[model samples]
Target: MTEPVRLTDIAELAKVSEATVSRVVNGKAGVAAATRQAVLAAMDQLGYDRPARSRQRNAGLIGLIIPELNNPIFPAFAQVIDRTLTLRGFTSVLCTQSPGAATEDELIEALTERGVDGIVFVSGLHADQTASRDRYTRLITRGLPVVFVNGYAPDVKAPFFSDDDAAAVQLAIAHLRELGHERIGLAVGPSRFVPSRRKAEEFRRLMAPVAGEAEVERLLVNSLYSVEGGHSAASFLLDEGCTAMVCGSDLMALGAIRGARKRGLSVPRDFSVIGYDDSPLIAFTDPPLTTIQQQVSSIAAAAVRALLDEIAGLPVPSTEYLFQPELIVRGSTAACPSS
Candidate 1:
């Protein structure tokens, strides 16, 4: 049996009056949609069953495919997307990829078999330069609505949303340069990924004026997007006499800090480091990380809107949408020790 609804508890939780709660509970017509949702959410939270008439009917199922949650940024994206879908009356099916797990193709097949209305891809195979575009083409040809985040495949006819990788690299380089660092190293992920390629290209272009083309190439280190990868890259860059470093992710930045410490060096005192993706709780690290922040909420909302438009048979431009990233300064970076 369901518990009795408590008007005071629900109203307080939803931040509305008892009358509003009563109206929502009774399925009254005057309450705004947002207000109704708030009331319903509050009721759900308080362990009260919503009146059958007030229950929401799901609009459709949206397939959300992303990388493993070990990376904090991926979860942040997933959470925003999931909440937005729920608010829009859509059910979201989250699919994650990892080693020994289902591949992207397999996940798509499963979601399609289950009759999802559309799909959202976050840093999936669409982002890999080496991956075939045929998979995406086939989906579009079948009249299925799809949207991509953080990756672009021009051959694939769909809306793409991403953070400006080149701009992020430029901002980090400029900040480090202002701190009087002459020899700065870049630690990024594999070149096959679109983001990594963009950052590397920009790093080479910007550093060319300072280090020259050939020497700038040596300053760029390709590694995994993990702490261990950052550590290994840091060791090599340190050997190259780099006084400051720009990392591809917060995880890598942490690894670089660890690497510096292992060599008996203090962060920002001996070496300055900048990271990408100002992910949650990063500001609370040993020496807070200075990073480029991706606009996750804006990107997620835009991608969801584009997918819904495509589902509604509305025209959406088949081009990439780039969102600007902000540079967040913290304790991880400082003036060059030698300067």
Candidate 2:
């Protein structure tokens, strides 16, 4: 080998001191496990091929494909999945899609080509009812370990992990109803997505009595799962005298807030809004959003574990695993204007 490497170099990469690297190098064994891992990771990151005799193989890699990162919820899920995978000794490679760049199909091909031991698709095309199911069937036929999240397609042989969208809507409606809001509207993404579809269907059923013909018609607004969409949808509902709104995503809720403000009204004071996903940064919002909180930690863990189970040839339940969402009460909701 070349002249003995300096301990200081490893310390810098590890963000520790030369003494810490020395301790790890000498195998004295008093280093905190995290610190030891840092030093070891630093070595790997530096491209210093460890002496063959001292090298250790990694557990394996998993490919995690997400739709986009603009929405905070996507990154929140990414963080949880990444940490959970790393802790379980699996390295997760996150591939996020850009507007016009590589699509999910391309990402799937790329990951499998690189030999990822398994893959977890979060809010991917698998969740799109219109997308061809053959793509997933092909992967299944090839025996690639895969898990689906936030959507269910029975034709594909993979475990589906999703939050209870219907239950989420039910909770939002009950919260508003209890607060004395009679004319409540559901602002959601297109009806194509599974979650949106589930919410819309449930909302109509739950509001049928309190929300009559003309009231319900003007109340249901189909908007994109975005802020602008929320703004636009809320504008229409506001004209119909809707005093409460349930949005599909936190971003849309932010948009709805903007919508309410445009009409010279304040949130929870002029109108009550509820959002889904409880995406990161929402808690810090101006009024803080009252939202249906997805049990992200549990959902992420279940997805990872299910993928691993599939990889080992162990059979996992094929049914959709539904986790109930809890409603987080924050400043965004309150007694209806009249109540």
Candidate 3:
């Protein structure tokens, strides 16, 4: 092993006293568990080799594949999953993909080669109706333990965990309607994704009682699940004279707010906006967003538990587990404005 890193460096990095760092390094008693953990984390962060006594044998490697980290919700899920997995004695290797980065297939192949004990997929290709299901089938054939989040593939034999997309839309619609808003529009991602399709279908069904089915389509806008996408969709909804809007993600809701402000409209006054996934810091946004809160921790824990069961050679039936979402009222929604 290389020369031991300086105690002062570890102490400064961990924000602990030098004596505390020395005690942790020397494996001395009397240190709080949390403090020891903090010192060790600091050592790891500082590129220091842990003393033999402080080293832990990893339970196993698990792969966590996600679409992208640009959105806060993905990171939120990652944090919870990572912490839970670590607490369970497993180490997680997170792989994130974007337009041109490593694709899901590439990451899967790499993880498989590395002999990962299990894999977790969040909002992956399994959620896209148009994507081929053969990839997941091959994994099942190889007897690899896998868990899917936020998407479902009937043909893929794996445990699936998802937030109730339909219920979320219903809640958003009901909240807006209770506020006396009739012309509420839905802004969501493309219909190719299962969650987006569910939201769109439910939105149409719920609004049919208010406006005819034909007008429902007019109020629905399918676009990317990004801020720019939300902004563009909100612009179109505004053109349709929508007084309230529901978005698929918090990023989109912020984008809608931006689009409204661009037109000199104030939120919850001239227009009301509701978003899905009450991501971190969303409550601190201007006119704090009213949104649907996904049970992220619960879903993550269930996904980990299901995967662990499969890894232990226990029979885990492949099925969809839906967690209910709740509507959190904030400054972004209010009674509909009177003409």
TM-score of decoy 3: 0.87
Worst 10 residues of 1 by lDDT: 49-58
Order the candidates by lDDT, highest first — what do you get? 1, 3, 2
Tally clashing residue pairs in candidate 1.
0
Evaluated with lDDT, which candidate comes out highest? 1
lDDT of 2 by residue, 4-103 (tens): 5577788897899888877767666567756766787787777655554332246899999997899988898999898777656678999998689898
Better of 1 and 2 by TM-score: 1
Q: Candidate 3 residues 1-339, lDDT tens each?
A: 667679998999889999998887776777775677778888989889888766445899999999889899999999989877875668999999788999889999999999999999999999999999988899989999999999889888889999999999999999998999999999999999999999999999999889899998999999989999999999999999999999999999999999999999999899999999999999999999999999999999999999999999999988999999999999999999974
**Per-candidate TM vs. native?**
0.95, 0.85, 0.87
Model 2: residues >4 Å from true position, as ranges?
1-56, 213-215
Off by over 4 Å in 1: 1-5, 27-30, 44-52
Model 3 per-residue lDDT at 50: 84
Candidate 2 lDDT (Cα, 0 to 1): 0.86
Model 1 earns a TM-score of 0.95
RMSD of 2: 5.1
